[model samples]
Target: MKIRISKATIVDERHPDNGKKRDILIENGKITKIAASIKTEVDKVIESEGLCVSIGWMDMRANFRDPGDEQKEDLESGLKAAANGGFTAVALMPSTNPPIDNKGAVEYLLNRAKSGKVQVVPIGTISKKRAGESLAEMYDMYRAGAKAFSDDKESISESGLLHRALLYTKNFDATVIHFPYDATLIPNGQINEGVQSTLLGLKGIPAIAEEMMVARDLTLLEYTNGRLHLGPVSSAMSIKRIASAKKDGLRITCETTAAHIAYSENELENFDTNFKVLPPLRSEQNRKELIKLLKSGKIDVISSDHSPEDEEHKKLEFDYANFGMASIESFFPVLYTAVGSSMDLAKLVATFSINPRRILDLEIPEIKEGVRANLTLFSISEKTVFEKMNLKTKGYNVAEIGKELNGKVLAIFS
Candidate 1:
């Protein structure tokens, strides 16, 4: 597909074209020209004054209910949503009916995703069947192209199981991702435990539930000396602990979602089910502290924890609704506006592009000559509204509907 993008500002901090507005010519899936005022004809021309280009974005965590629950989302639709969000790659959580706990499942995901523009990297579950019991075949899945191992949304309560899994992955340097939360602490939790929950009269999920789990995981990391990834550390206290752990040189890294940084518990005041998420949104101070962690480089990546729940499951009573928010396509725009007051464009691009691939140990692409075109064409000034009609996912659990924001995904070259 030959394409020419004229007057697109390059926002990638890794290359020399950081802030330059120049014409880029791509042919046969490779960048052919990136010089000033290039006279060329191509199959397509994407010219806009607000145009911006950067290294392709990647999301480290997203749940697509394929293979078992195709009514919610399949690989094809999920990847389409990902591409619409400007992500060239997305790491899928192993939360399917028959969870990806073996080599066959990993190979299945890779093969099934070959038709999509977005690359799907399956994250094998930490325990067999994601039961939080016996360890799964980590080495087997790793050899089968599993990028990371995680029991998505399931905390490993067994200290010995977590310890053993961590140590086992050391042989291949595979990361064991733990969703930090002590299930025992928030048994009947529905909303974040705070003033907002008090007014809404909903069961509260305490922040300490996540805090204690993070503390426990850090201790296990020290004891086993294993590669551990503490995903989506949401609270101020949790960030403090992770910062301290990093200072202690523990083999640990952490990230937070775009939603966490933007919205908070107050979003649930209307009893909107779409805003209901695990490790539910925290206080205003906590959200600011999360953004501060990004500014200080304590947080590693900013991902869209895009979990799509069907309308039937989402449009129920607050207590009975499934936990999720549909925001893959509107992710960049929503995030760009939400954090524009504080975050610079360069830093945001780095967090979205450069840091994620580093955390997953994947190849990072540079927007330069001689490299294949793995890029996201975007506009930071374009206005966007994330309504039901614009949603690309099969599900309809949109939390930010009617959200007016900046930054739109013009196109993606994968």
Candidate 2:
């Protein structure tokens, strides 16, 4: 098959044509030519006003409840949602029924994802069955193509366990991803601990829960000299600490979700269950701080945190609802709308594509001649509403429904 992307601004900083409007031609999935004009015959033409093309975007974190919970989301449906969201690759969180803690489970996801357009990089659990009592076979899972190790939403509460995991993975230069939260500090917590929670009478999760754990993880990373990735960080204090650690030259990286950037604890005022999330959205002040830090390059990635739940689990009372929303299908549009003007286009491309690949030790694709085309095409000028009609995932727990977003994904070639 042949495809032509006409007059789109190339957003890859590694390429010579960076920021230049050019026509890109692809034949048999390889980039054949790129120039000022290409009027040759093609099977398809992709063009739009204010169009931007970059090496395929990647989400560093997402949950596709496959293997045991296909009722919520299987590999096939999850990859379709990822492709629609303008991501050619996504790192799968190991938060399934059994959890991906062994080589067999890792291989299962890889083999299943082989048939899809969006590539899946499986993350194995840091503990056996995500129990946090003992370590899983990290070396064996890594050998089976598990790019990283994490307990995914289940924070490694035991200091000794997390320390050992970090130390063990360093032998192969592997990254240990952790969700920073001290579970003990936020028992029965429902939302951010603030005025919103007080008015709604929901038990609030204090910011110290996240801040304390981030401090502990940074300390462990420094002691063990192992690479670490802290994600879905929500508090301003955590950001301050992480920035200090970065300046001290620790082998650390971090991420925040698009939902955290776009919404805050105020969204929970109406008792909407969809706004419920782990590291539950903090104050409006923290939200603004997250956006500011992202523009300054303090945050390394922006993931969807695309957890999916069936209606039975999501359509419950606020306190009973699961802590997630189906977000992979609307990831790009929501993020673009949130920070498109304040951030440089090149910086946006880096966060979604280049940085995540580097952190996970994956191959970073480029927009050059003779290279295979792994690309995402989008338009900042296009308007889109992320309602059920456009949702590709089986999970229907999205909060952005009926909201007009600023950007739209045009196509993905992978």
- For model 2, the run of ten residues with the poorest summed lDDT: 332-341
**Model 2: runs farther than 4 Å from truth?**
none
Each prediction's TM-score against the native? 0.97, 0.98
lDDT tens digits by residue: candidate 1, 257-356: 8889888998888998988987799998889888877888888878888889888999999999988877688789878877873766777878778887
lDDT, each prediction: 0.86, 0.91
Task: Summarize candidate 2's per-residue lDDT along 1-414 as a digit string, tens digits.
Answer: 888899999998787888899999999999999999999999999989999999999999999999788999988889999998999999999999789999999999999788788999999999999999999999999999999999998999999999999999999999999999988887889999999999999999999999989999999999999999998899878988988998999999999999888888988888989889998999999999998888888989889999989999999998888899899988887888888878888887798899999999999998989999999999988988877887889887988888999999988999
Candidate 1's displacement at residue 325, Å, is 1.1
Clashing residue pairs, candidate 1? Answer: none
Query: How high a TM-score does candidate 2 get?
Result: 0.98
Name the candidate that leads on TM-score.
2
State in Å the error of residue 93, model 2: 0.7
**Cα displacement (Å) at residue 158, model 2:** 0.7
